[model samples]
Target: MSKVRVAVIGCGSISKHRHIPEYADNSNVELVAFVDPVIERAEEYAAKHGGKAYADYETMLAEVKPDAVSVCTPNYLHAPMSIAAANAGAHVLVEKPMAVTDEEAAAMNEAAAKNGVKLMVGHNQRLMPPHVKAKQILDSGVLGKVLTFRTSFGHPGPDGWSIDGAGSWFFRKNEAIMGAMGDLGVHKSDLIRYLLSDEVSEVAAFIATIDKPGDVDDNANVIVRMKSGAIGSLVASWTYYKGEDNSTVLWCEKGVMKIGTHPEDQVIVELRDGSVEKHKVGEISTNTKQLSSGIVDAFIDSIINDTVPAISGEEGRKSLKVILSAFESQATGQFIKVN
Candidate 1:
């Protein structure tokens, strides 16, 4: 098949750091257009990446009609932009925390199915080597049935990562909605579900905005009950002053598994039989390295092969439901059922 024509709908840090670069490197992809409210930003990326710059995404979508489009805009814009891209006859790959609410997420999924276009979410944690191995191990029953889990994903904050320092859209309640829970919590929710092959059934949470000078939450501590009768603790923070702490530990019937926690190994497996194994899974993307995500390549390949994306819109919605339900749990001071 000929190269897949692609457009990037947001020229933010994520697009510049991951999406644009990965798509450019893929021999099967042709960058066709770049869109950003700040037209100059789009122009800069277009000049370097071989695409036209547009201040308006609708205009670009109508004109270019790309085969695929990546939506890397603020949290609030994810659903509308993805639905628009699908409606314009383009497959969509959108950033995570798919939408702020279940209704919006459902709309996105419906739009994609209606248009016969695939929709994938950028839940990059699922693409990590160690996490992938953990899934395999769990499926093999080597760890037996997972009984409990503790997972955390934290960093200084998006002020340092987003293109607009301090005043980034991530700090805006209107745009980002739930802050740390939506930003980092959603990732852990998705990873836990993926690792155990279970859905989050209920959540009781203490979501707060501590230390971060914003109305949105900077800290989220949640207790979750999975459909498989497994319980877990999930913590997402923006006040990890020391550095990032992306880690998860699962306690199973026969053994324990550690991911992204230890210094030497990416995954550490210890069994009751006094046997231990260390897996040197490759490094995942960091701020300094900003390594390729492999998401763009997967999206392009799924289109070429005429298959559904591994992280489909429906899957993305399920993950979003976990976070949104956490917020509701915090507000009600009780466990919120994830439906």
Candidate 2:
């Protein structure tokens, strides 16, 4: 196919700020449709991006027959919408926290495989320039072995970013399934997995709704043990009122690698021999200052090239399992093994 015909399933903040604009910018993609329950939101995107606006995704899939679909809906709808699009013969690029349950995530993956379509997840943290560089450095054996680490992602909350402000679906448990953990924690989980090239074998956590006016947790402190015996802490909070913090510090045997910790440096490596290497690879996308997440480009390229996506459905499910295990750990007050 010369150009991959694409459709976005939700006209929410993520779709508006990331998918639509990126797809429009890509020369290999043709924006075919936009779907949203709020028809005006869809129409608004359609007007700017040259696509038909539909109130229902099912109808849009049937009518547009898009080659690929970006499932940018609520956390609960991700599996169903992605399954539907796959069944309709469209490749799917779903947002993070791919599904509410493990079964749902598996079902989505099954649907895509059965339909012979690509399934990519928006675990964009792995695609960040700094993260890519960090992975390279880690793989080069320069940091020796990652002994312990701390990764955190915190912001004021999604109220300012969501389309529905304070009453957004992000606050509702039924729609969001989780709050800070699902929103931010999963990203770190995926990043850690990617950087370390290891899976989280177990997790113990404390999850609570400390400050946010929502049923879901506003803060989570999770202790993770990787399969390689590396132990670390993963923190996710929606109560960072002052500013956003998306940083990771890895304590390795040879040296320490800090990512996003310094304002001027993206990755800082301090060796045991007292040498320092600071890398300004590129800007990591932030809540306030948005950048091309690179997810849309990767998804489109996978479709055009008929190759597996970098962040495949299985990868997304694995990262999501860590978050789910963290939730389970909090509920049981024990170290839960990630399956």
Candidate 3:
């Protein structure tokens, strides 16, 4: 079988940790180009993966003309890069948050639809084994009624991920519209939606610069009303010292499920029957990489077999709506409706 040709834009930590290795080692994909503004970085990436590299995404698009591209740039560039890739006749799998704004996300979605191509967002949290299992259990109705969930993702700061600690693009409000919430909080928001098989319709949030001392907020707490009348909460901070975990817990009338530790770990599902089911999955974790690969495989296979990906672009948009509304709620000091 001929593998689908893939070009990866923004050769950064994410692409390096997740997409690059997945593509390079996968038999169904051919990694053809690495795009990065930093020439040496691109070259280094290409060298490591045995693929060509380009300093410009446009140049790579025009030259390699890959079947698909992974837009792994910072928050600001997701829309433009995805739109450009779609225009160039390539399927686009954009990194999370989709875009800083709903307007940008809409434009990118429109562009992909206009080009008649697949447009997928990289919300890899949904692909985690525990999450997948949670969805299955939810669908099976074993949990009875879901009450709420507590989900959070936190770290010391952005020094490890961003190129320049507090001075990086993440710190720049203009370059990146929001901070920790948009970065880490959005993921949890999406996961909650995905796991519960519901949508967040209303959100009331509080955001502050409790740590890192900047205009961008480092910590946030949000109250959300899901479409199913399930009330939920999310808190994410980059200021947490001693490596706090990225964990999600779902509380139902009959049971509860928890994934990850304070900063990171396995998954545990507890049922009302006084039984516990533990599932531990790990393989190059990032933004929940197990879920990342699982969803990637599903997306690629769906394309090849003429099926639908478990998580569609529209599905992703639904999650984004909740995330954006949370931000609006924080800014307005009131509940923001998803509709």
Candidate 4:
């Protein structure tokens, strides 16, 4: 297909800021439909982006038959919506924490594979410019060996970003599954794996609903041990009242690599020789500043080229596994092995 017909399954903040805009910006994509339970929400985006709005996504899939669909709905709806789209012969670009359970994630992947369609997960951190450069540097073996690391993603809350604001599904335990961990911690789980190219062997965590008015946790602190024996802490919170903090610091044998930490520098590497290297690769997308996530471009390219998506369903599942283990750890008060 020269131009892939695209449909967005959610008209919320993510779809509004990232999926719809980025897909519309891509020359290879033709916006064909927008779906949302709230008819007005769907209609609003459809009017602006030139697509038929539908209150039901299954109906949209049947009617529009889009070449690709982005599942930007809540965590609970991700697996079903993606599977439905895939079964209808549409490629899928699903949001992170693809499913609430491993079985659901596996089923979504199975559906996409059975239908011969691509299933890309929206692990945008892996596509961020700074992260891409960091991966390149790590892969080059310039940094001797990673010994420990700390990665964090936090902001005031999703209250300001969600289309529904404070009433969004994000604060609902049934819809969102886990609050900050599902929303942000999963992103870091995927990023750590991508940059280090290693699987998490075990995890221990402390999860709490410190501030948010929800049954789900608003704060999570996870300790992970990678297969390569490197240890790290992953923090996800909705309590960073000051500002957003999406940063990662890796302590290697030869030096330390810090990502998204400095105000101006995207990456900073301090070597043991008393020398430092700073890189300004590009801006990382934040809750306040909506930058091109590069996820849309990659998804479209995969469709046009018939290549596997940069972040596939299995990759998403692996990341989800880490988060799942952390949850188990929180409940059991012991280190849980990542299966």
Candidate 5:
């Protein structure tokens, strides 16, 4: 296909600010449809982007027959929508925390396989230049073996970013499941795995609904042990009153690496030998205006080249496993093993 026909299944803030705009910028994609339960929202986007507005995604899939679909719906709807899109003969680019449960994620994976379509999850952190460089540095083994690390992702709350603001589906437990953990922790989980090229073996956590207006957790402190024998702490919080903090510090045998810790420096590396290397790899997007996640470009490039997406369905599932295991650990008050 010279130009992949694309449909986006959600007209929320994410779709409006990131996916839709990015797809329009990509020369290899032709925006064909926009879907949302709220017809007005879909109509608004469709009017602006030159596509049909759809209240029902299945109908859009049947009529448009898009070559690729971006699933940006609520957390609970991700799996089913992605599966439906895949079954309709479209490659899928699903938003993260692939699904609320492993079963649902596995079902989505199966459906994609059955339909002979590519399934990628929106683990955008892995595409960041600094994170990619960090992966390269770690893979080179110059830091010796990674010993331990602390990674965190936090912000004031979704009220500032969600399409519905304070009344967003993110605050509802049934829709979001676990708020901060699912929203932010999963991103870190995917990032850690990418940086170290290791999977988490166990998790112990303290998750709480501290100072958020809903039933879901606002803060989570999780300790994890990696299969590579490295230990680390993963924190997700909606109570970061100061500002957004999306940073990771990896302590290796010979040195340490800091990622997304400062506005001026994207990656900071310091060795025990008193040597320091600071990488100014641009800035991370903190708001909608700056949402150049490199996600849409990568997704379109993968389709154009017929190559596997960097963050595949199984890769997304592995990251979800970390967050789910943390929830289990919090409930059991013990370290939970990851499958």
Candidate 6:
């Protein structure tokens, strides 16, 4: 009946670029409180969004009592913040790669369930039109039995991210955990899962920080075997001198599909009969980089209608498990089974 009051736990780039704008722009939502260790950043966002600023999240939770909170903190903070939000009687919308470990992801999921709050992971790519269309085509049986697949996501290093060129948690091993795999690889892993409607059961991977001046892997790739008998490969890099987001290519028995903006652009469906259909999709984002796509709208709708989000916490955990396996596979030099 009333607007959903939302609080954002981090005021960094992601919060500025995606969560703040997304929550502010949604008509059914009210941006109510902001939180950041740096109070100034939180205050700025709060002033812009017509909400209160909070230097401490516990204080905010005790006072504002938001209906939901967006966990925009770093890789290491995601699990703890999400669990806290759920325990504080608020729903959660967490950023990608749910957590660094399957154990953490499971904990977040369990906390949400224990509190009876919905836990949604922001795998924004899945919200893109091209990805949505590709999933439809794959499920339509036009793709026939799946054969092999490849997907990638690459971006230039984060050095050029802010105008100031200041350093951030992205380069910190304690904060980032894994490099490209967590930053971009999870997107492709999640995308393929959504498109193929299957689980990645095993992984063989190579991870290295060949480019970025960080301890974590700025470049990595993995070969995956699906439970459904389809094989897949995931590649991601922050070392690309120049490249767009990325794309996923699937070759089934009857047809093939590609998603993301990097390739020929949008969702391209090519049938074995030599017929090709392409969609020139725009970004899922709006004025700000936050996914303005129908995906978040669907998340909101699911909350309102009491339906399950297609990109639920379980789905997010599945992707995290794959990326974690990728790291383990690289270490052991053996196929790692996903949990």
Cα RMSD, each candidate: 0.9, 0.7, 2.6, 0.8, 1.1, 2.1
Is 1 or 3 the stronger prediction by lDDT?
Answer: 1
RMSD (CA, angstroms), candidate 1: 0.9
Q: Mind giving the per-residue lDDT tens digits that candidate 1 earns over 112-228?
A: 999999999999889888888888888999999999999999889988889998999999999998799888999999999899989999999999988988799999999999999
List model 3 lDDT by residue over 1-339, tens digit each: 688898989887777777787777667987888998887878987887767989999889998999988888878898888999999999888878788778888888789789987888777777766667667877788777889888888877676666555567777777777888878887788888777767788889888888676577888888888889988788989887775667777898889877775233366668989998766555225532323465566657766775655665676677777778877887788889887
Give the clashing residue pairs of candidate 3, or none: 127-291, 128-291, 244-262, 244-263, 245-262, 245-263, 246-263
RMSD of candidate 2 to the truth, in angstroms, is 0.7
lDDT measured at residue 311 in model 3 versus the true structure, 0 to 100: 61
How far in Å is the alpha carbon of 20 misplaced in model 6? 1.3
Residue-level lDDT of model 4, residues 35-146, one tens digit each, is 9989899999888989899999988998899999999999999998999999999999999899999999999999999999999999999989999999998888888889
**After superposition, candidate 6 runs with Cα above 4 Å error:** 162-166, 261-265, 284-295
Candidate 5 lDDT over 276-337, as tens digits, reads 99999766667634658899988888888889888999999999999999999989898899
Give the TM-scores of the predictions, in the order they appear.
Answer: 0.98, 0.99, 0.91, 0.99, 0.98, 0.94
lDDT of candidate 4 at residue 87, scale 0 to 100: 96
> Which stretch of 10 consecutive residues in model 6 shows the poorest summed lDDT?
284-293
Query: What would the per-residue lDDT of candidate 2 be over residues 202-221, giving only the tens digit for each residue?
Result: 99999999988979999999
The segments of candidate 1 whose C-alpha lies over 4 angstroms from its true place after superposition are: none
Ranking by lDDT: 2, 4, 1, 5, 6, 3
In model 2, the worst 10-residue window by lDDT is: 299-308
User: How much is the lDDT of residue 90 in candidate 4?
Assistant: 97
For residues 1-339, could you state the per-residue lDDT of candidate 6 as single tens digits?
Answer: 998888889888777776777666789998899999989898987777789998888899989999988887779999988998899999888888789888899999999889998999988888777777777777788779889988888778666663224277878889979878998899888988887778998899999989677698898989989999899889998877765557678888988776664444577778989998887766444222445645456667777777877689999999898998888888999999885
Against the hidden true structure, what lDDT does model 5 obtain?
0.90
Clashing residue pairs in candidate 1 (N, C-alpha, C atoms within 3 angstroms): none
